[model samples]
Each structure stands twice: as structure tokens, then as C-alpha cells.
Target: MLKKVISKTIQLPDNRVITIETGKLATQANGSVLIRMGNTMLLAAVVAKEAPEEGGFSFLPLSVDYQEKFAASGKIPGGFLKREGRLGDHEVLIARLVDRAIRPLFPKRFNSEIQINISLISADETILPDALAALAASSALSVSSIPFNGPISEVRVARVNGTFLINPSPSLLEQADINLIVAASDSSILMVEGAMSEVGEADMIAAIRYAHDAIKLQCQVQKELMEAVGVEKTIGTTHHASAIVCYPIALREAIYADLYAVAKQHIPSKALRKEAFMAVSNRYREQLAKDQNGQEVTTTQQKEWLDELENQAIRALILNENVRLDGRLLDQIRPIESEIDYLPSAHGSALFTRGETQSLTTVTLGSKFDEQIIDRAMEDGYNRFMLHYNFPGFSTGEVKPNRGPSRREIGHGNLAMRALKAVLPPDKENLYTIRVVSDILESNGSSSMATVCAGSLALMDAGILVKAAVSGIAMGMITDPTTGRFAVLSDILGDEDRIGDMDFKVTGTYQGITACQMDMKVAGISYAMLEKALHQAKEGRLHILEKMAETIAAPRLDSKPHAPKIVTIEVEKEMIGAIIGPGGKVIQEIQKETFTNIDIAEQGYKGIVTIFAGNQEMLEKAVSRIKTITARPVMGEIYKGKVKSVLNYGAFVEFMPGKDGFLHVSEVRLERIENLEDVLEVGEELQVKLIGIEPKTGKYRLSRKVLLAPDVVAAGG
Candidate 1:
């Protein structure tokens, strides 16, 4: 039987088109779609369990995995395994992007385990596949029988030379000052995440709006393709429960007043506030049991009602009374305190605390050899700057086991890295490989933002010449659905984030936003609210930066005493071999003598040499040796020379590091010398002057009698 292949096309700005085809591959999957543009193709296959996991999950069990096949780019995987083992950070980030966009579109009561796997089967150098992952995943859902409220798609918007390009080529993306990946349904934006070069609030919103326009077109294409495939939304076929779980209205009425009172208490301690709320909830549970006259109340039922009550009370208090759980007004930030050099032995360290969240961050500098090798399917490069975020369970006052970095940690660290990477000095000026690690010692909310603040401070303290200090703030929103009254909270707490409608984080210098990420739990967020959040987040960020400035305003004059010092020099391309000598012998000797590390790369007509040493003295020694090796031999220039060999006719002396010259027997002394070894033994050091070069051999000539006194010459004659 012939397969029924269906495809749809989306025409974008600049006449670029993306095609989505179904029924061609992965036929065993519940739904599968292949999305392609400019020779780049991503195959997204989604599978959903008909029933929930054994116990029935309280939350949506959705997982998204994005992988890139080395065969996609016609390259072999690195490492001894010679195959992809685990998902790299980059792949995890892309999976997260897709997951965030489609997660909210699923029904709240549907707890089925859904897995979306997107693979890059074909790679295009100019066109990146990350921006297409979400589109493919959503398209797969659209064609499936799964109950989804989405035909959403994502697009990349980049502003280069004042023009906004949709899903631009990689080269264009590099020159973009405003880069954003926006996910949206046909009507509303769902997710926004990307980095910028200090772009303003208005421009950021405009970019999102611009991206949504393209997304609308792509979403429409998915809808058309789904219709063409004739897949009906059969909710009952899958274990999708459409019923809205309703709690006892009487229970809510009885507990809401007390919960609101507890919320209004302005309890500063997280633990205390939690206890107070729990007391009211438990009291209500007892009252309900008494009202029912011994009706059994399961913990799940009690929790469900209590959660509903707390959500109502906190949101009501904020909307009606204009106060938060901690009694701060809307748009108000929590207290901030920061310190630098907190760890005595670290190259650089800082402790940044905002309210209950704290990040103890440290900076480590290393040589080029320390750079992280990125061997991916589409690209092979080195990451000189890395930020690792560690969130131990103790940070949140829990007893969780340490199981390496989770997806959340990697995502947080990547955001912080992007936030500060824009402010780093050029590679030529800063040669050391930099790694910033953030350990969350205490966390209530926005620990990732604290990492940004602390990482900036630590980088500066480590004598890294950062262009500007960066800070971050997590903004939240609470909306009254009945009245459409919304409040944008700055520097939100853990409770606010849990109950809030939006978690929007912005990071940047004082000027504008450098990086931003927004995830909405609500159906959608208005652009006006987004703009308000951006500006509010900016105010909070600026305030936090003020606290940071009080600790360390700028980079130190130099790195710490124990930190390695790096110096770079350039030489003629032809001299690169001479510096390395026969199989790196010369470079190795120089390093051994000066206690330094050296690396050289040939670029264009020059060779770049980087030297890493323990101190200024050792650095100077290595630099001098490299200079001598690369320096050109000049006539009439005197130099300290080492005799490499003593022959009967002449002594072969190294006038410069790699340049050898012949010193005639007569040139060694004012009088005739029968044996050159008598005056100049092998490995002897002497002073000589470069005289001339042999016409055909390009050999150098050296002389020693040119500086002799006239009286001494007359006496010898």
C-alpha cells in the first residue's frame, strides 16, 4: 500500500519557505512530522501513553528530547564511544525551548505521559535548527489524536543593521544586536527567550511582536496540515480527563478569610509563613470533617482544597489590598546584600543575596588548554567561557540527594552565562579561559538571577576586564480574571512564583536588557503587561546593581597572586616552526626553563603565541625567549650568542634563538687561531656582531674583532 503523504508550506519574509511533511517516516509513532528549511530538517515524533502512570500524576508528565545526529552534518562523533551518549547542554537547551512552548497548551487535568523527540536529520551551516524544534513538535501534536489546544510555532527574530530578519542565517545572527526566539499561538505569545546587546524594553517587545507575526503564519500552516491529515481530536481515545476537578465551595468560603489574614501578616520568614498557612488549612480540614460528621478526608483532597484556598487568598490580597505575602507593595523588590572576595583562597569569589535567595559564586581562570571542547554534530569549537550552576538540596532546606546537574541547573547557568558574556572584553585582550561557578547556598526564588549578580562580581574581582557589571531580576504577575486587574511584582519570592501567572526574568547592564526569559502559566500575556514587567524588572536590576557596586565597582588592577598570568605575542607565520623547533622541542625547552605554558596558532600571515605563567618574572622570561626566536636577524646588530658547534674552519654560533651564523676562526680573536675549540667550545656563550649573509646559501656571518681597541690591534700586528 502506498503511503498517504501530506505536506504544507509556510512562506516567510524574504521569500523563505518551510515545509512540514507527515506520513513519510516514523510511522509507528502516535504522530510524526518532518520540518525542513534551507536543507535543515528536524523530525519530531511524539508518543503519549493512553493512560496516566500507575498512581496518576498530579502534574503533566511531558518530556521533550532534542538530538542532533552527526550524520546530519556528515561528521563522525568524537570520543571513544564514537556515538552520541548523553544530551549535551546545547541539546538540552533546545529541548527545553520546545517543552516550554507546548507545555501550557496541554489540558491541566490530563496527566498522560507525553514524549516529544525531535532530531536534526539534515544540517545547514547557515540555518540553525533550534528555532524550528518547537514548530516541529507542535506540528506533530496537531496531526495526532492527542487533545491539545495548540497549533503554536516558534520563530527567531534578529535585528541586524536596523532590519528585523525572521529566522535569519547564522552569519546574520552573529551581527544581530537584538536576537530573540519567540513562541506563540496564532493569537498570543507563549514563550520568549534569547540574548541581546543591551536592547531596550520597547525594542524587545517590538521584536516579540515581529516574531509572533511570522509564527501566526506558521501556526496557520500547521492547522491546514492537520486538517489535511483528517486527524480528529478524540479526547476519550486517550486517557485525557476533560472534567474540571471542583472542590467544596464551603471549604473555600470557610478557609479563605483566615488564609487572607495569614497572607496579610507580612511574615518575613518563609518557613514561618508556610507554617501559618498550613495551620489555617489544617484547621479548615478539621472543620470540614466535623461538618461531614466523620467523612474520611484523604490527604490529596485536603491538599487540593488548601492549594485552591491559598491561591485565591494570596491573589485576592495582592489584587484587592495591593499587598504581597511579605507585605511589600506591588513592584517592590526585596532587600539585597552582596560581598566580594568571600572565599580567601579562590581566584575570585562573591556572595550575593537577594531576600532569601543567595548565590556564592567563584571565578577560575585558566589557559587555552582549559577551554571546553564542543564536539557537536553541526559545529566543533571551544568554549572559553563557561558558567556552572549548582543547586544543592540544602539550598532549599531539603534532604535531596546530589545527582549531578539537572536540566534546571544547566538551563539556569546558560542564562546567566549569556547575561554576562556580552560584557566580557575581547578575546585578544583577555586570553585566559574563564569559568564561573555558582553554588546556591540559600534559595527561595530567583536563585538564577542571584547567580548572575554574583558571577559578575566574581569575574570583576578575578581581574577579568568586563565591559560592565550585569544584574538580573525575576518579575512575576498576578491577574484577577474577573476584573482584569494585574500586578507585576519585581524580585518575586518562591511563593509568588508558585502562585503567579508569569515568571519573567531579565538580566543586563544598567543600560538595557542583555538576556531575558519569560514563561507564562496563563493562557497568554498581553504585550502591555510584558512591557510593564520589563520596565519593572529593569528598576529592580538597577537597584541590585547599586548594592553590587558598593562591594566592587570595577575589575581589579591584576589577577590574584596565585592565579596564572597570560601574555600573548604575534610573530611572522614562517617563524612559527622555529618557535616550536623540531617537533615542539624549542617551545618545550622554553616552558621548562621559565616554568610557563605556551600555545601557538597560525592565522593569516601571523602566528599568535600565548604564554601562561605563574608570575610576572616567569611571564617575562618566556616572553623574552619567544621574542628572540621570532625576531628577524639584522646586520650590524650585536647579540649574546651560543656556540652550537666548534669546527676547524669556524664555530657555528646561534646569534638569535633559531638563527645560526658562522664565526670564522679569525673572527673569534684578534690573532690567528689554529683551533676554534681552544677559544670557542660547543655550548659556550659569547658576544658577536652580525656582519653579512652569504649570497647563495642565505647563511649568516658573524664577527668578534669589530669592537677591539686600536692599540690592541697595533700591538698584535
Candidate 2:
């Protein structure tokens, strides 16, 4: 039965429209939505494949992809390898963004394989595919049978001339000093990624609120779509809440009372608080063990009893005493120490330590060929500037195998990458490939933000003419005791992050924000709180930037001596074969002799050669060889030559660039010579003069004997 459904589409100022169609598409899935804004469109379908089998779900497998086809972009794939085959970094990142926004809304027991594919049928530069993908996924989940506790919306916010511009175009974004992407549910924010100058916390929060306000209509449109086409609600099976074990309430109260008093008198260190909590837990355990009723308890029962006691102690400490594990004011930021130019070999390097969290970021510059290439189903190939975050087990005081990057690492890296992407120089202006690697030396909370701060300083130190200097700060909020009142902290510690309601990270330059990200542990935050957090974060970010600038004010104008030297050469299509030789023999000989790395484009007209030697001497040698191989002879040029073969009338002399010219005896010299060998031998070097050119053929007529003396020529004859 085809049901006619009403769809709503709201047009925004930035040439973007939010559309929701109800009665059409993917009725069987938990939720589905087809979103179209401008020429950019995506059909996002959300379906949960399966529920958790045995253990509780620890991870959410959410996939988000932005597929770009040649047809959509009005261009075909440009290589001999025609079809798009693999997912690029951008696709992986967009997938991560949607996953982060939606994963938090699912119940822990609903650990199912949830897949959301954002298929791009058309593309418009203004309406960002990423933000559209988020809306589509949210709408699909809201209408689907899959249990999603969301109808979220996202927006791209930019600051141009100190004014917040929502969903700015690509060109407008280029002109704007700050670009921030924010995704929020009705009440709380879910995701943020963008870059700015060193912007204040107050402004950062304002930007978030602005984005929330801007996208409210889109969220409503999604809701209307669900009302129109959403499937019938499936009754979700609820799990029974765990039973709370009985313990001595009086004894637990007394222990917590004493511990609270001690904590109040002396701000206990993290280790001290942990030890004191453990001692109280052990005492309660002993009391249970010595119960005189002869009641034997199982291990599980004992653990439950201990867990209850621990929860009580923690809850009492927070609710009654209003004190944290590590004593600090509710809004107080952690101490920070930032230093740049720490690595001698790297182009730029910085070490940023905020409280216990520390990130060592390094930047590397390379040729255009070094840019990342991404290929996936929906999108063809594209290049990217990348950021990679690494978290070793030692960063958290644990011992684990040293392996490749985890999904968390990828997620963190992508977040930082997105934040900085707005400020990265365009490909045409800066041809150098950029790679920023953030290594977490220690982590407490928001190490990803620490990575951003360090990365910015490293970029500046490396002398990359970035649009602006960027710094990031992590903001945390602790709600008030009675009301939902909260205090936003600048730099949060590990415990604060665990207990806090929000982990908001803002990165940008002094002029404004470049990137911002926010995640919540509780329900969404109010606009006022977000404002306060941003205001406070700005102050903290500026302080960190000041410290960073003291070490390295700007990126060094020159690259490191150890860095690779790249030289690009353009050769004619016909001459490419000659330089490459048959089966690449000629190119191989050049590499072996010069010890350089040479990469030739598949098109055969352009080549990029990288020399990693200690000095320019090796680079010059390699360039000279390439020039010789690809060089062509110019008309009306003189050269020193050697005669290879002689005829009665003329002698064949090697002259010009990679060519041989014929010297006739009549024009060999002023006086005629009896034999060609009399004046020039097979193994002799002689100065040759070009006198005439053959128009039909490219061969040149040279006179070697013309410059010889008459007496010398006659004597030789």
C-alpha cells in the first residue's frame, strides 16, 4: 500500500535546506531518512543487525560513510584504476562522527551491529555532506524499529568579523577566521570539530548555542519526518535493575563521616583518597566476614556488599561534603605547561602537558604526492592532510602490547584532524604534504585536546605558513548540588572527567575558534552553561597559547636539514618513454647511481623525485641526471663534441644534448682536408660549430674543421 506522506523542508540562510520525507523509503529498518540540501543529498538508513548475545555491549560498531561518485561531482575517476575501491580517511572520519553522536543514545544491552550508510547522489559545495549525514542518520534512527533515544541535528558554525555565521559556504569559510562544526541533541551537545584562532571560552560557548539555535528547525523537520513515516514502536525488553545488597547502614555512614572530615581538613591526593576508600571497604568486608549468625556468603554476594559500600561512600562524599577526589574549586582548571621546538629533527614539535595529560605533537612536511588518497564506494579518490594520535599503554600507567592504533586512537586523531582542517592551507597555495602525529605521554582527561594544542604549536614551529596559530583547551562542568547549576572547568583531571557531565574541547586561534568538540555523560546542557564553559575555555586556551608562543613564536622559515628535498620535473609525453627507458631501465640506473627516491605519476608526463641525503649535493646530482635524460637539443647552439665515425665526405661527431651531428669535410675548416681522420681522430675532442640546419629533419650540420688553421690542416693532410 502506497501511503502519501507530507515532508517538511526548511531553508537556512547558507543555501542549505533540511528536508524530511515520511511515507517513503526503508520502512523495515528501525529508522530511515532521505535528506536533501542543495545539490548535496544523502539517503541515510539505520538498521541494527543483532543484539548482544552473552556479555554486555562494551563497544558500539557504528559505520558512517560519505560516498562521492564521479556522476555526482560531474567528473569521472581520473586514473587507469577506474573504480573507487577503498574507504579514504575522510570517509572513516565521517563514519566516526555519526557513530559518536548516535552511539551514546543506545542502551548498553542493545549491543547490536548498527550500520548507517550516507550515500551521496549529488554534491553542492555549500551544504556540507558531513552535517547532512548526521541529520539523515538521526532521522532514520528516530523513525526506525531500532531503539534510538535521539533526534539530533548538527551545524557548521564560522566566525567572520567576530560574528557567528551558521552553515557558511566553502568560500565564506575560507574568508572566516574561525570554523566550528557542532552536533547536538535537543538539550545536550554530542559532537564538535572545527578550528579557530586563540578564541576565548565565552565565545566558544556562544558559538555552540548559536549552532544549536540554528539547527533547531532541522531537528523539528526530522521529527516531523518520523511522525509521517516512522514504523510502529516495538516494545523494548527492559532488564531488571540489579538488587542492592543490604549492609550496615549505620556503620557505612559513620565511616564516610570520618573520611569526609579527613578529606575536608586535608585535600587528599588521588592515591591517598583511593587508599582511604579501600581501607573503609575492607573494614566493612571484615565485619561481614565476622558475622555471628553463621551465615556463609558466596564470593558474588561479598562483592555486591563491597560495591554497595563503595557507592555509598562515594555518593555521600559528593552529596554531603561537596568535595571531589582531588581537591580543587569546582570551576578551577588544571595547571598547564606548554613548550614548542622540543624535537631537533622534526620540522616542528611541541609538548603540551595539562595536569596529568600530556601530548607530544610533531609535524612533518612532504610533497603533494605525500597527500593521503581515499577511495570508497560513494566517493572517488581525494587527498587529505592527516593527524594521527597514538596512545601507548604506558600513558595510563598500564602494561600492554605495543600494537597499531585502536579505534579510540583513530577517533581521537580524526577529531583533531577535523578541528584543524579549516585552518589548513589550501592545496594550491601550499603544495607540501602535512602530517601531524600526536603521542600521548600521559593521560588524565581530554588528551585529544592536548594533542590539538601541541599540534598547533608544532605546525607553527615547523614554519608552515598556516592561516593562524591554533590552540585547544578541554572544558569540564560539574553540576550544582540542588539545582542543575554547573561550574565549567578549564582543564579537567581524569576523575573530574569521569564524574563531570560534559567534556567540551575548544581549539582555535586568538582571533576566534577553529575547532570545537563536546561529549556529554548526562542529559544535554542548557545554553547558559554552554556559554559559561566557552567563556572560561577561552581564557584557559589563551594562557596555554601564551606559554606555547614563548618557546616558538612562529614556524621556522626553513625546513630541517634532515628533511627530504623534493624536485618536480615536467617532461613531454613522447620524451617520458626515453627517460624511463624500456622497462624502467633508465630511471633505475639514475636511482642506483644517485641514491634517490623517484616517484613518477602514472600519467607519464610529470615526475616527483625525493632525495633524503644529508645535503643538497646529492639532490643536485640527481636533478642533473634527470635533466640530461629528458633534455632536448635547441636549434642554433654550439657544443664541444667527439667524433665517433668518419666518412669520406663527412665525420659523425657527438654534439648537442644527447644527439650526434654530421660535420662535412667541405665545411670542416677554412682549408679542405684530404681525410676526416687527419684533422679529428676517433678518440679526440674538438670544438664544433653549427653552420646550417635541415628543416625537414631535426639533424644539424656542424663544421669542426672550419675553425682549424689552414697550415695545420695542410700539414695534417
Candidate 3:
């Protein structure tokens, strides 16, 4: 017998319907929901394998998979390797988004092995899979017995020409100056990702509000689905609320005042700030310990009090004095200094520093064959241009083992890549493979934005014809409605990002936006605020661009000497066998002789060979060898030949055709010769001319001498 389930569906204004089917699939799982919007559909299933072990709540192992099958888009897998194998960048990012949104929803002790799978059955391209995946995962966990707090919803808010567009189409997104994906749990924001030309705090807040309101209907559907078929939620773990202890408010106020006074005396450095705070915390702890009441305080309680004091001091410093810990104004951006051509051997290189954050971005150009081939469960394609961000431990004054690129690096690189994608030349006849590597030498806040600035300069230094120079800025916001106050900060600092409500990063060209990412710690923002932020961001971005242009106006026309030289050749189908010989022998010989890298297409008609050397001379030598091996010999050509044999009337001359031709004694020289050996010798090269062909005899007639003076002939005789 089939189990009956409750499901709800709502039609969006864009003619797309979102459906939440519950208790229909994956019944054993904690929560399951299948969401279908337009032609795109996703089935999200959440299951908690086990609860946390004793005293082991270090981290959450939440595995999320956003899989895409070739069949979903009516396409077959390409390449000799016929299967999708790895998780693509897109898949990893979607998984990260879902994990970030749902991980915080669970209680602290609920360390369950949460596994959420989002399978894309169809893809319409207009509906982004990442936001939908986050929504489905949140709803699925809510209706499950996995002890989740409740349902959550996500929406993509884009601003185009000062208008807020919720869940805009992919094409419309191309024109948007700011794009933000916000995930909320009704009252508070859980996750946010955005990019802009250089949006300010106000516009970013507006986008958050637009997305929050736009997702209301979807949230309602999730609630209805839970009512219809959700399993009974498990009771949350019980814990006692911390008891409030009275400390003299005047004493607390005095302690904060003294702390700020001491903070002002110290220089603004991360170490300085840490030491100052530690000293104040210790002084307060000592004072509390000596109280006559002898009220005992746990270390945890003392630490919490210290944290609250620190937060208050920092907030007060920013709000009342309008001065950051670093002594910068509320809206003053950090100092930026950029330089291009920093590396001698790089095709393009730039060093970008904003405040203490620094990044060295380098660009490399190669042939189309150098493009990265992606084989993933979600998507399969080739990317000619790639951006890689590297953050070493030393960049943050930390000690950690070095390994391959981390998830954070990948995500940041992808964000930069997306922001610059709009300005890249189309992948048509221009088939150069471009790769950019951004190394974060120092980081305080918004290193990714520094990467963007440095990357644009590096591309120009490498001679890339970008549409326009691009720059990025991180905007921060602090809003206290109780005081009827709000402050929008430009180029936020690390502490500002930590205590502030939002980290809105906007990157774009001078013409418009190219990429944007926004994340908020508070509830959400309004549309009006987002618009203002975008406008401010554009101004900030343009200022940064001006500074960058002073160092390098455009990409360099010449590449680095160390880079390889690519030479392409097209041969006939039949000649491919000759080039390859037996088991690639001929090609291997060419590689060995020329010291060149040869990449042959599987189709055998086209080949791209890369020659790497110190200069063009070596490259030319390699090209010459390949041309000779593949050259077609021509008939009736005058060539230097060696005399192989001598006859009574003529001599046989061996030419490059691997055949011998006759040189008549009468035509051997202008003067008559008694023997062929007198005028010519074996193993000697002699100039021979093709006279005519004796068709009846099928022999070639060649001559060394056609006419001579009679007197010279008589003298020789």
C-alpha cells in the first residue's frame, strides 16, 4: 500500500510554480522535499545518520551534494572518457551554500551526520540551482526528525537600473549592477553571497529586504508542507539559562572608559589590539575576584563578561567617536597602492595592496589546448580562462600545513572569475587559454577584493583586451534602531566585518557591474538601501580603477620570454599516418629531436605543437625540423646530387628523391672529358639540371653542362 502525503505548490509571478512534496520520497530520511520550478526540478533529501558522541561537539560533518546528470539537459557525455566523474566548482559551491545555511540551524549539541542530496532532474538555466538547493535542504531538515530549528528560504535579489528584480532571469542578471543571494530563517539571515561594481551598505541592505520579502511565499509553502506530512519533531536538548549576576553598572562603565583610553595610547595593529584587550580583561578579572561579597565566578562566565565589554567598547568607539580601532574615519577606505609588472618572468603581474591586505596576481596566456577540462557530476565543459586564489598560512600570521587549494580558495577564485567574466572576450576565434593566479601575501579584510583589483591589472599587463578595468570594495553597515542611527562604512576592516552586520563585496567594470556578493549577520536589508550602496560602490570602484591605471594603463602587448611559443599545423588525413609512424614512433622522434611538446587531436586532422626555449632561435629550429619531416617533395627541381656510378657515356647522380639520374658525358662539362672521374667524383655534390623526360624509356635526362665555348672545349681536349 502506498502512503498518502501532503504537498503544497504556489505559482510565482514569472509563470513558475514551486512545489513542496513531503512524506512522498525518502521516508526513512529525517526530512525530504522535492522542489520543481519551471522546467528545472530538484529533489532534496536530508538524513541524520547518528547523534553526537559524548563531549565531541567540535564540528559538524554535513555533506551536501548538488548533482547534475547529462540526461537532465538532454545531452550526452563527450570525450574518450565517457563518464562524469568529479564534483565541479559549481557543485562544490552549491554544496557549500546548503551547508552554511543549514549547519547553523541545528542546536550546538546536535552533531548529527547530516547528509543532504540535491539531484537536478532538469535545468532551465533561468532558475539557479544553488538557491533552490539551499531552500529544499532547509525545508527538508525542518520537516525531518533530525532536530532542526525550522524551515528556511533563499532568494536571489538583483538590482538593474535602480529596480529590484527577485529571482531574475539569467539574461537579466547579465545586466544587473548588483546581485546578491540571501538565505534567511524568517527572522535572521543565515547566508549571503553577492558582487557589485562597488556597492555601498545602503543598497546591499535593500537587496536583502527584497529577497526576504520575495521568499515569503516559498516559506509559507514549506510551513504548509510540514503541517501536512512532517514527522513529529524531536524535543530539543534542555539546558539552563545562565543566571544573571549583578555587577556595579558604574564599575562596568568605568572599566570600558579606561579600556578605550588605553586602546587609544597603543598603535593600531592586530597584536596591539589583542594585547590591550587581554590587559583590560585581566584587570577586570582581578577586580571581580577581590569583591568583598566573595561571589565566585567560573572561567567561562568571566570570559563571557569580558567579550561583552569588548563588544561594547568597540561599538562605542565607532558610534560615538566615529573612529575605528585603526583610527580611520567611518567611511574612509583603507590606503591602496598598486604596481604592475612586478615579476620579471610572468606574462602579466601586479601587486595590489589595500590597507594591510595584499595580493600578487599573475596572468598566463596559452593555446586553446591548455584550457581546463572539467568532468563533473553536475556539469561538463571546458574553461579557457581560470582564476585561482591562494591563501597561505603566513598571510594571516597563522601556522597551518600547506596543501592543495581549499574550498574557500576555490569559492573566492570562482567569485573573482565570475565578476571578470562579463568583460572577457567571447570564446570564438580568439581561443587563447588564460589562467590567473592570485597569491594573498597579506590579509586583514576583503583579500578577495584585492585579488580582483590585482587580477585586472595583471590581465592588462599580460596584454588581454578587457572591455574595461575592474575593481572591488567591501562595504560594511552598523545599524542601531534603538538609537535611531545607522552608519555605512567603506572598505571595512577585519573587526568591523566581525562586529558589523554585513560584508558586501562589489566588483565591476567602469561601464557597469560584473560581479557582486553580499552577506549579512542581521535579519535583512531594504531595496532603497541596496540601490544607494550600488551607487556608492560605483564611485569607489572608479576611484580604485583610477589609482590602478596610473601604474598600468593597459595590458602589455608582448608576453614574457619564459613563456612557450605555440605553432599550429594542419595536415591532410592520409598524412597523419606518416606523421605518427608505428605506435607514435614518428611523432616521438620529432619530439625527441626538436625538444618540443606536440599535442595531436584525436581526429588526426589538426595538431598544436608547443615549442619552449629561451628565444625565437630555438623555436625556429624546432619548426624547421617539423616542416622538413612533413614537407612534400616537388618534381623537376634542380638539386645538388652525388655521383654514384660511372658508365661509358654517362654517370648516375643520386638526388634527394632516393633515386639516381643519368648525366651524359657530352653534357657533363663544357670541355670534353675522357672519363667521368676526371670531371666528377663519387660522394660529391654536383649541380644538375633536369633537361627532359624520355617518356618511351621512362628515364629522366639531366645535364651538368648544356653549352660551352668551342675554344674552351678544344683547349680541354
Best by TM-score: 1
lDDT tens readout by residue for model 3, 1-717? 796776788666566677777767777777787787877878888876554445333356568887787777777767776766666677788777777666656765455567888888778767766668887887787688777765778878888889988778878988887777788876666667766654555666677777777677777777777777646866344321112544677777878887677545534577677788888877777676533356776665566566667776777677777777788776667778998889988888999999889999998877655778875434457888889999999998999798887778888898888777667767643446889999999988889999999999998887777877888898887777687466677787777787787777888776666676766555555454556566667777888888888988766665666765555566555555666768988777766776666665534455544444334566687667666555543445666778898877889986543346788899887777887767676777887767766769757677767424476447661
Candidate 3 RMSD computed on C-alpha atoms after optimal superposition onto the true structure: 6.4
Across residues 1-717, which tens digit of lDDT does each residue of candidate 2 receive?
975655788778655556766546666656666777767767777666655445423345556665656566776665697866565556666776776677778764455667777777777766667767777788777777777777787778888888788777777777776577788887677777666555555666677778888777777777776766645656353331223334456765676565555445434345565677567656666665533345555455565545544544444455455555566554555677888778898877889887778999999877655677754434445465889999999988889897777667887887788667767777645656789999999988789988887888888777676776667778877665466545666677665676566788877677766667677765467777777777777787777778667767766776666765655666666666766778988778877887676666535455444333334677788778777767766655557888888888888888743467888888777776788667667867777877777888978888755556677467762
Predicted structure 1, TM vs. truth: 0.95
Give the lDDT of residue 214 in candidate 3.
Answer: 63
Query: Candidate 2, residue 574: CA error in Å?
Result: 10
Question: Per-residue lDDT for 1-717 in model 1, tens only?
Answer: 788999999899999889999999997888999999989999999988877767577678899999999999999999899998899999999999998888989876777788999999999998999999999999999999788999999999999999999999989999999989999898888889999999899999989999998998898889889889998866442232213334466765768888989999999899999999989876766555432444555566567656876898899888888889998888788888999988988889999988899999999999998999989999899989999999999998899998889999999999999999999999988998999999999999999999999999999999999989999999999987788899999989999999999999999998888999989887778888888888888888898888889999999989999888998898999999999999889999999999998999988989999999988889999999998788888889888899999889898998887889998887877788887777778888888889999889999999887756477467752
Q: Look at candidate 3 and tell me the lDDT of residue 455.
A: 94
Q: Which pairs in model 1 have colliding backbones?
A: none
TM-score ranking of the models: 1, 2, 3
TM-score of each: 0.95, 0.77, 0.76
Query: Candidate 3: TM-score?
Result: 0.76
Q: Who wins the lDDT comparison?
A: 1
Regions of candidate 1 where Cα sits further than 4 Å from its true position = 237-251, 288-295, 632-642, 673-686, 706-708, 712-717
- Model 2 has an lDDT value of 0.69
Q: Distance from true position, residue 524, model 2, in Å?
A: 2.4
